[model samples]
Target: MPETSLPVFIAPPLRLPVRTIGRRTFDFSRQVAVMAVVNRTPDSFFDQGRTFALDAAVQAAVDAAEAGADWVDIGGVPFAPGPELSAADELDRVLPVVQALAAVSDVVISVDTFRPEVAAAVIEAGAGVVNDTTGLHDPRLADVVADSGATLVVTHSLAAPRRPHPRPHYDDVAREVADLLARRVDVALAHGVREDQIIVDPGHDLNKTTVHTLELTRRLGEVTALGHPVLAAVSNKDFVGESLDRAKPDRLAGSLAAAVASVFLGARIVRMHDARAAVDAARMVEAILGWRRPVHAVHNVS
Candidate 1:
């Protein structure tokens, strides 16, 4: 062996969280899960109403499941501070998809919403998890999840839903994100939510600059160290786009790299727009970590 100058990187031990959704329990440390995004909003940055129609949203969720996604995340509105959409309008866009998909698929149905009413309705419409990107701003959202016995994803965002977080600041972005997530997890517990039912996300690009998101991604282990399964929604995000100087449609490679990086740093669940590719990528990581075995070891065995 020749003298080496390359740095050796060792992955840290992951403290994964286990939770049961839709009567199925998932161990994050042992298995990587992909939550496919199906945004039923016309202003969605990625697809821009491609799946906004009721039938299209339903078909998209089904397609994601067939593509090996562990579940689907349905959203009615964009998180950006756009025009205010009433609860009824949000439900009209989301409920039909949830009802249609839940009636047919066992893949977990996760609804992305911060409003308590929307959360309640979706949970009733067969949603097993509420992907609240608001970091429990309402707290009533936690109540709805708790009351419905549904899983809750507490994502870190400084601003209220549909409100602009202008010129965001953080002394230490990673530390602050972790601290805020810890605080929000505590709030969920206080609101009668079960520990196993909670998940944390750093909310990349939601209210963060590209630099801040980069730091957070590099230091995601801190968030994972909180002992709740950390979810990274890095699919086609502006950070990935800006980091690689690629536009949204061209960010697949960056998105996979970021998603895999998050996995290396201890993220258990990856929310992605490209479900099939993400599922394949996640499984590859799982096999590399020895968390999952290869489907067939025929390369040498044969």
Candidate 2:
């Protein structure tokens, strides 16, 4: 009789899950969705107030949708350590943009905030996802998302929103991140958020050293194994900048490489700063992987 043995390698997901946001339903198994980043904060790390104005943010979102973005993640506050922003102030920044975009387009709108008040308000304003980068630090935010039936992006981070988590440490970066995300997902479920309405993010560069973020990226398959759609927000992240010794503006190639790697490893969604480029990269990756068909496949076919 042959002895039974444990598997040496884990297989990639045969198909990614599907999630509906706003008026659109994305089949991640057949598509790598592109989520454009539109920061409404003046201190945005990458844009630095480029879309801080309400008009600018609205226009950026519309352009991203036109450029093939499946979703627009509008953030009212920078994830980096910063002074606290009041809920009212955050509302003032993102609500109008959400309302504006909802009126004009069906592009899935997601708001990057962790405050319960802000989460509830935005969901009411037509936002479909609550991108909480704080790892459910305030569990009440989960309650808000649950009540609204909005998709909650459960992210991993060691500190409160806008607070510094200097010298963060992890035993196994990927495993730890997966564990954190899984726990947060459970917390969301316990608070009444459904399983299908949940997404997971490893939170690259959020309270993590470049080395930590790199290891997490290489081992991203573990996070995807959690059975929820994984979102990789690798656009212009410090990890890419530091790894290739490139400045923020020069990290485009590295960012696309990271995003592609994440998709290959089973990420169902990619959140990017460069919408058109990211959309192209994602489609190319999907075509190469046989998940998407070429626009013109007439080279050999008569």
> Which consecutive 10 residues in model 1 have the weakest lDDT in total?
1-10
| lDDT (10s digit) by residue, model 2, range 1-302 | 23333222222453336767778998776578999999999899999999998899999999999999999999998889988889999999999999999999989999999899999989999999999999899999999988888899999999877888889999899998999898888999999988888889999999899999999988988898888888999999999999999998999999999998888777878999999999999999767666667898889787
Per-residue lDDT tens digits for candidate 1, residues 250-285, read 999999999999988878889999999999999998
TM-scores of all candidate predictions against the true structure: 0.94, 0.94
Q: Give the TM-score of candidate 2.
A: 0.94
Q: Which 10-residue window of candidate 2 scores lowest in summed lDDT?
A: 1-10
Residue 275 CA displacement from its true place in model 1, Å = 0.6
> How well does model 1 score by local distance difference test?
0.89
lDDT of each candidate versus the true structure: 0.89, 0.89
Q: Looking at candidate 1, what is the lDDT of residue 95?
A: 97
- What is the TM-score (0 to 1) of candidate 1? 0.94
